[model samples]
Target: MNIEDIKQRITGFSNELYPFAHALIPEELQAQQLVIDGISFLFADKDCKTRLFDLLEVTEHEFVNKEFFDLKKVSIKVIYALAKKRFTQLESGLDINQFGVFYRLGLSARAALFLKYKFGFDADEVSEILSLSRIEVMTLTHESRSHMVDFIRPVQEGLQQ
Candidate 1:
């Protein structure tokens, strides 16, 4: 499907997941605008609608649990992770592909950890929930430390609102 279609699907999924005021703009108009802007920023040359669709599909699969209804919290974490990685990559002159993979993995790992912590899961339970081996879980936990700081500090700030 096209970017507009993908965005509409995301909006529908978001609406199902959380209670929020609808945008003043018409849904399709807003979706189209978002698609256009996102493409301009992220994938200027080639069509990114398909990539966005893939990302959203993965995110939807990962976040379907009722515990993730807090979209604001999830969004803050994601933004913080992306920003942190971007800044670090700039400073270190890291390969963009590596930076992107780390950022995405960090976000997913953080979300899984948040679910485990908030939901009070045992080790076995956490492993099962995340579909990760113990070694992978440990590695993710270690790698996620800096990202967690980035992800959580903003959420704490937002809580003051």
Candidate 2:
């Protein structure tokens, strides 16, 4: 199939799999486009699919038995993660105008890291790994850490409530 056809299929599948995911995303337009772009990349390249599937497998394994958490909350957490990462990368970056896209990227990066460190998947195993360069990976790592810190602190504070 052509790239457009593959993107369409992937979009349809994503909507079905994560029906609430779109709404939870910060930037609607960018979020939608990212999904389309990811699918298009997967369709046009076999290696990309392998990497994506590898990451997916890792996510599934890590989250399989976890308690049910609000997807929206998770989405917010993911966005925060991405935003933090992007900001660090840009250092002098402005606020993310495309919240939806930012959230999606964060989610993707989180899933990728979870798979790599949490599930023992090597960086080379997953598809189109988010950080192909040292700088990108470092930025992502810092963002992910910040996201986690922000995410957990709230919960800790809530428990004292």
Best by TM-score: 2
Look at candidate 2 and tell me the lDDT of residue 39: 38
Best of the candidates, lDDT = 2
TM-scores, all models, native as reference: 0.28, 0.32
Per residue, candidate 1 scores C-alpha lDDT tens digits across 1-161 of 34575455545544321211111111343334433332234333233334454454454554433322332233322333343444444434533344333344443464445444554445554455455776776666666666646644556656784
Stretches of model 2 off by over 4 angstroms after superposition? 1-13, 16-25, 42-122, 126-128, 133-143, 154-161
TM-score: model 1 vs. ground truth: 0.28
For model 1, what is the error of residue 39's alpha carbon versus the real structure, in angstroms, after optimal superposition? Answer: 33
* Error at 49, model 1, angstroms: 37
lDDT score, candidate 2, position 87 = 40
* Worst ten in a row by lDDT for model 1: 17-26
